[model samples]
Target: MALPVACLFASVPVYAGEEDIYFSDLPMVASVSRLPQRLADAPTAVTVLDRAAIRASGARDLNDVFRLVPGFQTYPNNTDAARVTYHGLSDEDFSPRVQVLVDGRSLHSPLFRNGMNWALVPVALEDIERIEVVRGTNSASYGTNAFLGVINIITVDPSVVRGFSVSANHGNQGVRDYTLRQGGKLGEAGNFRFTYQQRDDDGLKDQFDWKDKFTSRLFDLRADFSLSERDVLEFSAGHVEAVTMRGRLAKSQNVLIGGNNPGWPIHDFSQSSTYLQAGLRHTLSVNSDIYVRYAYVSDWASDRYLNQSANPAYNYDEAGDQGVRHEFEIQHNFVPLDKMRLAWGGSWRNDAVRSDTVFRGMSWVSRDVFRLFGNLEIKPINWFTGNLGLSTEQDSLAGAHTSPRVSANFHITPENTLRIGYSRAYRTGSTVDYRANWWEGSSLNFRGNRDLQAEQMDTWELGYLGDWRGWRMSLDTRLFREKIPNRMIQVQNQVEYMVEVQKIQINGLEYQWKWQPFDTTRIQVSQSFIRIDSEFLDSALAGPLSGLSAVPRTNLDQLGERSAPRYSNSILLMQSLPFGFEFSIAGYWLDKMKWTRNSWQDRYSRGDVRLAYPFRWGPRGGELSYTVQSFEGNHGEFKSYGQPADRVVGRRHWLGLRLDF
Candidate 1:
């Protein structure tokens, strides 16, 4: 647009003086322990999804922007095979207890140990520039699955993305999309950016069936360099190629797929992913600093769920899974004595996985991990502040572990704050729960258990923060309690080497609010209440649960309460009109839930709508939009209990355009 707004002001100034062009009266939150503070002194519970709340939330993937995050829960299915969770321990899909990152690497992959392949998310929400969301569980600063939450993702700084852009989108099932972006400058200290994306869909359709068929293409790049005033550098890379559709989901033993039962052993797999990362920062003074980062990733997938004529000797013939990972990290930050601030780091990771269908042969199959971490923040006076964090981990396949966190903060001014925290976490097993061996030859089999052990948790928290600025408002709150003890579950036909165990507890409250009394209106609200209690502790070595149907009593009793939603709420609104035209709305409320146990899906409320318009020609600028999803029409976000057309979900509309040069 206008040459990226005239190279974003040729040298500087997009937001230098601030007049609240849209939001952010003040904002700074950096994944809790990776430093950068002041979300009322972080330490836990942080959320920020800036960029005018992602352009007023007309979200198109990126998992629908966490449905406006608050105890985040996703799994309403629009497909790219979606899954997301935070406060609700969602199960059976890639989310594996949530921890996601972009700028700080880690996109969690050992081939979907628990989650996050959402069809190869390699960034393209207009290069997302913000999305913090730490919302709890700091396994001592991100080790140990970060236990229940973390979704960092930050982008945009390529000298502020100087120029070129394009975009398009089209509607209804089978939607199509495209994007292209480019940035500039590389002299006088450097800068760079790039993007390319494509999409295809036709996934959730009504009238009984039509399922998850998706396609993707992506490429991303970033570069920055200063290499002077004490060094600075950053680089990133990405690639993705995809195809999707994986049906055969028996709704946990219910068998349904509409129109005279369609979804049969559906297939269509193909996948690819790649990554590269780099980082360097050095500024050894002014309070100290040193940092390093590295990342490498590779992934591949194939499908036809293995059959080579039913295991033609089983060496490999496309079933899926291939992964590689390498990570390295280093850090040092200090202020040894100035009201204190300390950080220490260590990390090393390696994973190699191969699968012929959850582990059979193709070789490669490795795992290694090592970590050490430290965090400290202190004030010791003047309104208090304290924090401590630790992390230690070593694993070849679950062994040594440690995670800890402690905090206290009370500011009561500077807009108010209060907090208390505690944390501990560990969760291991994934790589198909330590090596799955789902032998398909003899009709079926499931086995994996390299003597698994390492699911433990303990958490506690209380928090509050408030900002008024004369009622241009903000408020946040949290209360939590959690407990877990060996929850592994991966069984089929009872249990044995496959896995099963449970013990859970969770109690919670979370609330959020933001308001901008004017300046083209804005409002956001979030709510969550949770309660989950489960017990099965290896039900006598586990039995029962073999293709459910005895309705009214068979998902083995709430079994971890399916896709969560113990209680939830979300509201969003954005407004500005009269000429440049724009408006938005969102509402969601969910409660009743289940995804394959006790088959149910009652509580529901969904609404979404967006409209936009803006134009300019001489210097370029663009916008055009329309979106409607559900909007309270034919809705169903996964229901079960037999013949519900197997998880039906629908309602959609789209139309979009963007341009800038």
Candidate 2:
């Protein structure tokens, strides 16, 4: 690709000097305009991840910190429950199109099939203080899983935390983890923070035929309150519980070669989740603000498997699921003139789901959504900047919709910018995609379609942002195209249902570059280049469908054009090593892809490293670390259907200790 963009500027010059691109030194992104702006005038394309790049990317989860972001994708497995996607339409087991917030609370639930269960993520990565990631299609500022992207996750502000901490991890496949934190001062205008965590693993070792494991636990809390000088209140709560290791193993134990399907063997996939949130914000001057919020969530799961062939119709719990949510919101931000700026909001949500074993005799399959959003931002000259957004949804399961977006940046001089955008999104179909009724004892495999329809997309982009702070470098690029005329495919001619049939198209070019280059080095690089195309919408088959390799459209347009990963890359390097020691390295590469539709994954590579040391026993501060995951040793990013060797991701190794009181 132009020799990796000419070896990344061969050490210099890739546009600089507009006083070295400083908009107060960039980085402000508020999930692409609920109004924090600046990330070169955000109207999409953001990817912050700071907290020192999430502890320099040795990513112990948070879905591997999105593999350092460019068109993200993930698969560290931890025995099922980790899967992230960004430019891909993934689902072998859920990734419902992105949108996973935390501070604003929506974790795409319907009990995880609507996605967002990176092993019950209840935040504890040292309290995360950053991670914006908006990339594209924000469903007009958050609606319907943001239709394709948005992951806010802010955290860390219990009055900027102060207090105790503890941490631990030990690893190598059965990697254990632990954490505890506490912050104080909750009596004079509040401030609080608390956390507890645990994680365990043993997954993907020659991977999948059972005995891959996981365990989890978390509790969390946050508080803030300063309710007077213009109000402020905030609260949070969290929980997560888990156990995983599910299914597979048979074919007379030769691990599947012939057809003697003994697939539901190892069980225990229980899960639990809970959440709460509250907010109030007030400050209606100094350029205004107002806010209100509420949130709640609940989830449960079970896996019920038994039937060592005495076949009572396979004894089903069929992976039970439960779900819940409740939300309310209100917001307002202002400056309505003086070069405009605005943000408006409204929200109401409800969403319930219960399962009589996957909805066969459903009881609570509720849905209700209502939203109204707005965004404005104008800058009228001083080198232009404009943005307009809209959202309006009223979805009682796939019904009303409206999403819009528009952008234009062109700052072309105060540190380089140039953007152009367009958007139109809609996606709503999940209460099992409009009520699934999956039965198995009497055999009705899949069916759900209360006339499901709400999958539309359209995007177009061209962006660039550069800040060279005289070679401390920065860059972000995007060049997209997305179209999804109506895609929602879960086909299976003789049994399954839920169809909207494909159209899909995606074209991409992603970028990210960063460099500190001195003062103890740092660097980052990212790349992507994708292209996908799909088909199968000839009114979705009734025989005259000519191709897609036949039988139920078998390859399904090569599974949506290989499901994203037509080249991918990531790199990170941290440095800072001498006496107080620190080091890092992160790497990834991908090419072969497709995570389902008869799996096919191959070209993947990984590398990770970390080393640290920092100590002081006097005022107590500690750090002592070591990590190595995959270390370029075993690979396979996920693939195991008719297994022919994939799913192995070995190497591992860990040791960490935090302590600070």
- Using lDDT as the measure, which candidate wins? 2
Evaluate model 1: give its TM-score: 0.32
TM-score of each: 0.32, 0.33
Cα lDDT tens digits, model 1, 240-301, are 88887654433344544333222234567787889999999887766677789999999888
**Model 2: colliding residue pairs:** 21-415
- lDDT of model 2, residue 152: 86
Q: Per model, how many backbone clashes are there?
A: 8, 1
lDDT of each: 0.74, 0.78
- Lowest lDDT 10-residue stretch of candidate 2: 1-10
Worst 10 residues of 1 by lDDT: 1-10
| Shift in Å, residue 642, candidate 1 | 33
